[model samples]
Target: MRIFGKFLMGLMLVLAVACSRTPERGGYRPAPGPGANPQLGDSAPHSWDGRGPYGQQVHGIDVSRWQGDIDWDRVRGAGISFAFIKATEGADHYDPSFQRYWRETAAARIPRGAYHYFYFCRSGAEQAAWFIRQVPREIGSLPPVIDLEWTNSQTCPYRPPAQDIKRQASIFMDIVGRYYGQRPIIYTTVDFYRDNRLGDMQAEFWLRSVANHPSVPYPGQRWAFWQYTGTGIVPGIRGDTDLNAFAGTRADWVRWLQARLTR
Candidate 1:
């Protein structure tokens, strides 16, 4: 939610100077979505190397404004337990439909949460400020998440050095904490953790580990969610869509979800 360019120039300089000594805590790397793995094309069928046909438990999708013409009923029919919808973006950019869908899902009674794409180029406080403006004040929903990963898009291109990336993430998390009022989950990869020492943060992590089932690359560490694949097929959803299986069970889903009453 932090806007880019708001405080990036100053923070960029700070991260550049202080990144060599950050320590490694522990973490997870989510694999790919059920749709298109940036590494793989859209032609790849939605599937995973782990559990046969993925887990029969809680399932869901995280969509950006890009995925169009969605049939959410099919998604509901497919037994999706929850969905983390893309809401606010760095300081300025927001999906046009973020509010619309936020209300839509609220009406549909889908288990949902909002996410902010982290910008390593900015300070955490600024990013958090941007996110707070976007997210409505409400309670009992899924915890806010800080989506931190390597993204080289045009609007916010101009990558920082790798160590600086870690510093930026540290600041981003600090900022997100200020507003969200919870230690938000960090979504990132193994290499990012290793390179940036993200393990040091030890915040609740949503890992992208693309292997069979949920296995920790770094032993003796606990991870919150493991993203198994970008390609996934679920019953009721049209064609094949990307899917993610949580590390726990249906009961876990019920526990984590915001307590909302729906008829």
Candidate 2:
């Protein structure tokens, strides 16, 4: 009986240690070793050469109708701290899933924002007005995002001059800013950013750099969010989705939300 009691005590101690190491749902977990390829405990299939999205304390996804139906509860449980959903494009086109995604993310208690995909063929004021009509002016929502990138559309392939692009973007952002009472974030690709000199703009940035860290591609440009991968696989998402990381610690994320979230 004495030997059996000692064996049971040892087993219990082992189980306790194991349980302590298990990550809680929606809790932050440190990344694996620097040399580790890809991400050890993440669902990403592609490998990142440097400190990747997993290294960040706060991770999130940006989605559109292409993602199909999502299980928001599972996404939140899988450690998605926030979401940016596609709301509008051009002057008349609205994403069919915008309302559903907005509603579900809120129900899941995840901070959610809307993004407008800029159409070069349309005037910025028109596009901004379209976005304002579609997205609600919620108090706790994340600030709006304006996606600026070159498109491969055969019908609307007109690339405006750099100065023109900047002017239009400013108009859109300024109008949206007034409506939301928060400065908007500009989401841009590397080529678009460099070509348009977006760094000169007085707005926060969400940069896309999938090959390497944003610092490698963007150089000295400060960024609020870095989209590290577009082929990321998360728990609730059916197919690939864009994954992004906040450029701060967990405490910084809390502070940012307090300061930057819609009033």
Candidate 3:
């Protein structure tokens, strides 16, 4: 009886130590360190390899009026680190929801920036001025983005020469960058980027490659952001919205923001 009692106490002690060392199911897990595997959570997740955008630590979204009535609080709470709201298109067309998104995102404490969609018919200078007039010079804003892409508008089918496109983009970036005190990011699709030889440009790139990794499509190109999907189902957004990932870890994201966010 004494030996049996002693054995029972030893068993209880071992079990207690094992239970304490083991993690509870659904309990807190430490955030991944730099170069560590990131936790993946996307509604329409891709079968991404270890090097894909899912591996990126910082994720964000770009929104236009099409997203409609966003719940900025939910978006911020959903682990979205930043946003780029469409402010202007061409020289005259302003996105109707730009102001609301800008205000709400600031209230939610999400780092926000504005983007101007380049209109083929409009001069770069004219479009840049329009964007400047529309987007406020707010402190702590992310650097402005110039969205460069080919549009299928019947009103503006003019595809300028590569040299001309480069020149116009340079003009827009120069003006917008000077105004914002940060170099503008150029957002472009694979075709548009190749056609315009945008790789030669002296600017950070936000490359779009939903089907494959940006490295696969944009070989040898160093990118700041990768637009990985256009049919993303984010919690705060209605319908499909574009999803993007920063090119570094959480710490790297903070450092980049410190260096590039508008003062």
**All predictions: root-mean-square deviation over Cα?**
14.4, 10.8, 13.8
What overall lDDT goes with each candidate model?
A: 0.57, 0.82, 0.79
| Model 1 stretches with alpha carbons more than 4 Å out | 1-53, 155-167, 214-220, 233-240, 258-263
Candidate 2's displacement at residue 260, Å, is: 0.9
Q: How accurate is candidate 2 locally (lDDT)?
A: 0.82
- The predicted structure with the larger TM-score, 1 or 3, is 3
Per-model TM-score versus the true fold: 0.70, 0.87, 0.84
Q: Which stretches of candidate 2 lie above 4 Å from their native place?
A: 1-26, 33-46
lDDT of 1 at 261: 12
Q: Model 3 off-target regions past 4 Å?
A: 1-44
Per residue, candidate 1 scores C-alpha lDDT tens digits across 1-263 of: 23323333332333223222221211111233442211112235435554532433445676666555565644544445456778876767777767876776555445566788877556666777887788774443466778877677776776677667666666766766655556577777766656666677758777776654434464454666666556555433334455655656554544444122110
Residue 88, model 3: lDDT of: 95
In model 1, the Cα lDDT at residue 140 comes to: 36
The lowest-lDDT stretch of 10 consecutive residues in candidate 2 is 34-43
Better of 1 and 2 by lDDT: 2
What is the per-residue lDDT of model 2 for residues 129-217, given as tens digits with 9 covering 90 to 100? 99999999986789999999999988799999999999998999999999999989999999999988888999999999987889887
Give lDDT: candidate 1, residue 126.
78
